[model samples]
Target: MADEEEPKTAFVDESAVPSAQASGEENGSLGNSWSEVSDMRQGLHQRHVQMISIAGTIGTGLFLGSGTSLARAGPVGALLGYTIIGAIVCNVVLAVGEMGALLPLSGGIVRYTETFVDPALSFAIGWNQVYSGCKSTFCDKSGKAATLIQWWITINNAVWIVVFGSVMTVSTLLFVRVYGEMEFFFATLKICLIIIVNVTALVVVCGGGPNGVATGFTYWRNPGPFVQYLGIEGALGRFLGFWTTFSNAAYAYAGSDSIVVAAAETRNPRQTIPHAAKRVFARVAIFYIITIFFVGLLVPSDNEQLLSASGTAASPFVIGANIARIPVLPSVINAIVITSAWSSGNAGMLNNSRYLFGMAKHGHAPKIFLRLNRFGVPYCAVLLITLFMSLAFMSLSKGAATVFTWLQSLVSIGALITWTTISVTYLRFYYGCKAQGIDRNELPWKSPFQPYAIWASLFFLVLIMLTSGYKVFLHDHWATESFISSYINIPIFLVLYLSYKFINRTNIIPLSEIPIRPLLEHAQRFPEPPEEPKQGWKKLNIFWN
Candidate 1:
């Protein structure tokens, strides 16, 4: 008698598996191929998932870019701006958690789109995310082409792209499981750095410096707080400055949703995802609000130090530290920024690989991406995404500042699109649940305020996107060639969507027929673990021994 085939989930779709297998062989070695990979091995620990999510959101952008926002908006303006953006980020997180918890599949937003909207929409979202991740990586310090070749051969931005991409690819291949652990350590390091900076600034403001002096919030009073540039008369310049600052604040919060990329690797994703999602608001509130508030209090917004935008070393925190006569703090902070850059780059590469893997699994990309190494890593996808991320180095060759600005704009636009999709997906999900008569109480985690929260997030994101491009419409003098290039990413997205639709002959489905119910039902089966118990003295023994 023939041996019985092993049991597999009906969802695996064996017919689809053949294409992926064929593609795997043609591309390259699948790496670590093994039969009978266990689900537990595939799943990441809850701690890793939660920490990675937090690390993903707190990037070099926050450390290096917040200073620019402070300069654009006075203390008060910057505070208010971040608060508003935080609210929007909170709403987006809730919406994502709702859909993510309901369908804990690796497809993430793409899967949500497929279930709540159309296949084409899913394809577009996944591919766009992949493209955005790759594009954004160029700004990573290690990935800069000029820096890479400066020590050796002279090459253009193209060479930097390939070089950085190869490095990321190798890194991803060498350490898949350790990525989460590394993120956890990096997050801790960043958190410590912020704490030190905040404490030092507070000390300086409270007369703890060598001279026992205080700035006394004089910066706000002198500038009269605001830079109204567009006004025919009074405070209009201040308002425009505030707007520019707010845009920077929003950009700082851009990649918060990166946590979703690791959904596949998360253990008990339903619980882990919801728990992680709930933290977004608190994280933003504490981190952004408190940090900005203290900075405003310690260093006046108009200080010459604050106005400098030279590099990461010229960060407002560093500038404020130097002015306050703090010894060695600036150098320490600079070192932290370098580490933060690496952490952010690592997270970016990880996310891009997952996005590619999800696309391949769904047939939106080549099947080779679906192949996993014995370590259960998507090695092929990781290699390709790393390759593309190196393209970010091209900015260094062309001009670092120009490349950074344009890429930053693209990142903002990509995030806006993603947030919009999340809201719309949730709206459809809400009604789909109702029509199917599924009780809300049965959900593992339900978003509060129902459809209102979803709509509110959508509204805010649209407003940001419009306002982001507002400079182009309002002031002729404000128009720069770089400003125009910033908006190019939006058109790129539209063209990609239209071209895919035309080629695939895809049509949007009616809201009634959305496949949300089935996906939700399938997801509901895998419940999350209860919160981990608080550590006791005995718990420390495992590490000590």
Candidate 2:
């Protein structure tokens, strides 16, 4: 591959780009922008990258939350909800993959925001995601705090909180391979859990369980495939309930950008990152959609346990197992779910810290965060962001539950905004490539469906955000909590973007001014190593490949 030479492509000056400086600070702790993309060590191997994506994407949200979705939206509505959200998330993964293959930069959407859109917007998204990302980690870790109690373990939550928190923290601080292997083990457990859940559901659906009731489609017929929200009998209530699924589904698929978040630290990223992205979407999408379909068949929407707040408590599969009179299944599902929560927390921490590190390198964050550890991680950024893990402790507080709920709302909205930003940023990159006479074929990876797919993702993401709190306005259904939680992030994002724009005095970059050619040419010069042939079991190992 290196022997083949191509015609020269013209490069552009980055200074012409908005708020983009190519130089590192005088101290040199912060490396040159494009030269080292935060200088993270490439400690993650091919399998590590794949497992991280798999482990992070499959979490408690899918394990237990699907039951609640079924209760609110019914079987048909829940299936529709997960399907639409999964498609949108798949689009996001594609967009991010295409960009990451070419740019191979850390910070994920934040880096792409600065390069393709505007640096100021990058500042907004970077800070917003940092806040919300930590909140998500809080959600996952707090879920773990509830795990012991949910399984009747009788352990002190605060004590286990420190222990879980310490394990997650130490894993991130060490060599990245340590994090990768740890997630690999967790991911293996998660996959096995999913297979078990699905198999058990299928068996019960076919009347193979202890009771052998053979209720095939019986519940769907009785519940009639839709819910009447707030006792508003008729199609209007069912429609409202169906609409609520988008919010719920969005919460489950929040971190779609994670696969490419560590491009700088991944081995052979041009190949590794995008390959992981493409496969992750397909695998994760099917896992959510098919699993939801099975869930609908196995459990009824009106079951009271579906109303439980914790995923383990409200898990449809667990409920299904209970219906089939399988006593050990609940504990098994609960154990797997505990691991899923911890796995997601590991991913959340790793991605958020990398975002901070990239922001520091790009002058959007404090330079102090540029400092890296001996293992090549941004130790300072990890240390600073780790403080937010304390927020998870609020879940243990009796009165802080409401505050935590509001924070979760804000975090969910933040995820919607993030996917929306990704769509917009990729659109800009697409047009900029066209304007500069760069061919998509020449890029390291090209996404199919182009601008149309991205536009659709953007459309649905906006619609979901706008309608997130629709229930609050449904005459006589107003709730202060719903109003605050639903629409609060809109103003917050606008204020962050606008305030940073005015304070920094930056302009929205013109398509012509975007330095796409330079980055593309850089990618051309430093090509990734050709992928080696897989032998024997590796070729047969469909899951990891």
lDDT of each: 0.65, 0.77
TM-score (all chains, Cα) for each model: 0.84, 0.93
Best-fitting candidate, measured by lDDT?
2
Per-candidate total of colliding backbone pairs:
13, 0
- lDDT by residue for model 1 (1-545), tens: 01111221233222222221123422211111112222213345566666666555575467767766676677888888888888888888887887777665565787677556655677778877887766766454444323423323455546655654555566666435577667778777887887888787777777887668876676667664654444424577677777666467666776687656666556567778887887776678767778887777766666665544245433677777777877787777776666676677777777777777766655678988877765667788887875565455455553666666667777777777877877877887888778777777777688778788778778877877767866666656566765665566666667776777787666565655555544455455534446666576857631111
Runs with alpha carbons beyond 4 Å of true place in candidate 1: 1-43, 140-167, 229-233, 304-309, 395-398, 478-480, 523-532, 535-545
Tell how far residue 399 is off in model 2, in angstroms: 5.8
How far residue 129's Cα lies from its native spot in candidate 2, in Å, is: 1.0
Candidate 2: tens digits of C-alpha lDDT, residues 124-208: 8998888888887855555444553547666657766677777888889988778888888988998788788888888888889
